[model samples]
Target: MLNMKSRYAMRALLYLAGRYGDGPVQIGEIADSQRIPRKFLTVILSELSREGIIGTKRGRAGGYWLEREPSAISYGDIVRITRGSLALVPCAARLAYEPCDNCVPESECHLRLVMLAVRDATADVLDRLTLADPLPGQVELQPERQAAPAQ
Candidate 1:
């Protein structure tokens, strides 16, 4: 599950995506519309801005907007940036792998194998989505959808 900050970030990013090319949006508007706490939103937006996922301006007309096109930003990108990894265990992480404490070696661990599989499947689903993708219930996938290759 995603942390509150990351969840807030996604909502804010989605808001920005919808308002793309409409110019910067005020932070308060995003917080109010998304029901994220105003102070917390400021921190989240600032982090996103620092990470270059969103751009900010300051002035009477200043606000925040996505640095890239909405379709260019995927759910995977957001997850990785905010949450670090899709893995339930640290060892199963692709980008931030580390051995789990008190665990058996990788080659001998059944749990690790299952977790790696779960992580890949999770990445497949999340990576397949972008802010521009139709909402979950809005689009239907054919049965022909492919499983990700083995890890």
Candidate 2:
């Protein structure tokens, strides 16, 4: 399961994406708009800024904005930045890996292979889903109209 930090990061990024190209936005505004607690969001934003995922400004109008174009930023990027890895199991992780306690030899572990597949699929989906993509429920996917059945 995704951690609170990752969830908050996604919410903050979505809020920033909505205001992209509008210049820096205040932390108070993002917290309020996203319904995230201002105090917790402050820490998250600071970490994101440090990660180069976001840029910050100081003063009355100071706040935060994406350091890169929204289209270039992916959910995977934020999740990896906040949570460190996308893999459900350490042995299946790309960046961070540790042999599972039950597995004697990782090279021959069948479960590791399955976990890796799951990890890969998750990475693919998140990497392709950009911050610029419309927020959930903001757009609906509709099926094409079906043709009349032949007599």
Candidate 3:
């Protein structure tokens, strides 16, 4: 349920991860290769740069690059930075918690408890995964696996 902004952030991060140690990648190249809007990427990159997750170099050959190692940057970190909280329900949010606007007492709300569990479970998976990890079911770029998989 992550919004387009968050998805784009991850996509951009992945693009950089793929080119780690290769030098900064221009924002234009990122937008073109990732199919993200250049204007939107400018805003997104600025935000990410402010967050210390990315760094920018200014000049004709300058661009953006990851500030931290790919292994150190988790999906949860990106989501939290862009989305604020992983909780589907505001009352269950750990980083941006706000009580429900109702008479129901927080301690007695079953729904709140379930939502908290959901938030934790979601965080567990995302926090453990990073851009360096290969995605499940993604085919390797090897000649041996070019053919179709077994039925």
Candidate 4:
């Protein structure tokens, strides 16, 4: 499951993406528009700012904006920055792989195999999607219009 921090970060990024090249946006405006808590947004923005994903300014005209183009930023990138690894389990994590504390050796573990496939599928979708892409429910919710993967 996606954590709240990552979810909020995505929302904040989407909001910024919408306003890209416009100018800095005040924290209050973002919090109010996105319905994210003000205090939590401050922390999230600070973390993203440190990552150079977003730039900020101070004073009455100060706020935040994307440091890079929306198309340059992938949903997977945001999730990785906020959640560390995309894997639901440590053993299945490609970037941060670790054997589960009490599990069988990876070579013999079925659970790990399933998790690896899950992680790969998740990455496949998220990495292909950028902040500039219209999310599933944004333009319209059309599950039937989405094609299934080739066998």
Candidate 5:
């Protein structure tokens, strides 16, 4: 249940990653190519720049570029920046933890245990996915093969 802002941030980062080391890319071009509204991208880019995730240049060739190599930037980095928290529920959150209203003791709560497991799994997956990874289009979605019937 990723929010729209997080989705947009990822898209923008992916666009930059695909064009990394090519010099700065125009903000308008990024917006057009990614189908993100220019005004919104402006705000997101500004935030990213402030966070040191991206660098901006000024002048005729001025635009935006990644401050570090794409491989150095993980999905978790972007998610954390854009969404503020990776957990779906406040109780599951590590940085923004707030016990659920109904739960008296989060430490022993079965629901919290399940949610924490989910949060860890999700974080692990995202942390491993770097911006320098192959583009989505390059990934071949192989259909599942049918298994032979047991003898």
Candidate 6:
């Protein structure tokens, strides 16, 4: 399950991406448009700023903007930054891997094996997709048609 912070961050980033070259977007506008809390968004944006994912300005006209082009940032990078690991479990994590405590040895652990596969598959999809990609809900899909019955 995705955490609220990650969800909010993605929303904020997407909103920023839409306004990429238009200049900084005010926090209140983003919050009201995306339905995220102002305080929470402030914290998230600050963390992203420190991570170099975003840039901020200060003044009467100051606000936030992306540091890099949206296409340069991948969903995987965002997930890793916010969630620490794409792996469903710690034992399956690549950068943050840890042996399961008081459990079967790694080589023989089926759970770990399954999780490894899951992590890789998840990474494959997320890494290939950038923030510039159209979000799932944003795209329209054709509805399936019914098949005729055989005589």
Best by lDDT: 4
Over 1-151, each residue of candidate 4 has an lDDT whose tens digit, in order, gives 8999999999999999989999999999999999999999999999999999999999999999999999999999999989999999999888888879998888999998899899999999999999988877777445676778999
Give each model's whole-structure lDDT: 0.89, 0.90, 0.92, 0.94, 0.89, 0.89
Candidate 5: which pairs clash?
none
Candidate 4 lowest-lDDT run of ten: 137-146
* Pairs in clash, predicted candidate 6: none
- Give the per-residue lDDT of model 5 (tens digit) for 102-150: 7768767888888889999999989998987775679844789999999
RMSD of 6: 8.5
Candidate 4 overall Cα lDDT vs. reference?
Answer: 0.94
Root-mean-square deviation (CA) per prediction: 10.6, 7.2, 5.4, 9.0, 9.0, 8.5
State the lDDT of candidate 3 residue by residue for 1-151, as single tens digits. Answer: 7988899999999999999888999999999999999999999899999999999999999999999999999999999988998998889999799988873899889999999999999999999999888889987465564768889
Q: List model 2 lDDT by residue over 47-120, tens digit each.
A: 99998999999998888999899999999999899899999889988988887886669877888899999999
Q: Which sections of candidate 5 miss by over 4 Å?
A: 102-104, 135-151
Pairs that collide, model 1: none
CA shift at 4, candidate 3, in angstroms?
1.4
Better of 1 and 2 by lDDT: 2
**Whose lDDT is higher: candidate 2's or candidate 3's?**
3
Clashing pairs in 2: none
TM-score of 4: 0.88
- TM-score per candidate, in order? 0.86, 0.85, 0.88, 0.88, 0.84, 0.86
Q: Lowest-scoring 10 consecutive residues by lDDT in candidate 6?
A: 134-143
In order of listing, the candidates' clash counts read: 0, 0, 0, 0, 0, 0
In model 2, the runs with Cα more than 4 Å from the true position are 135-151
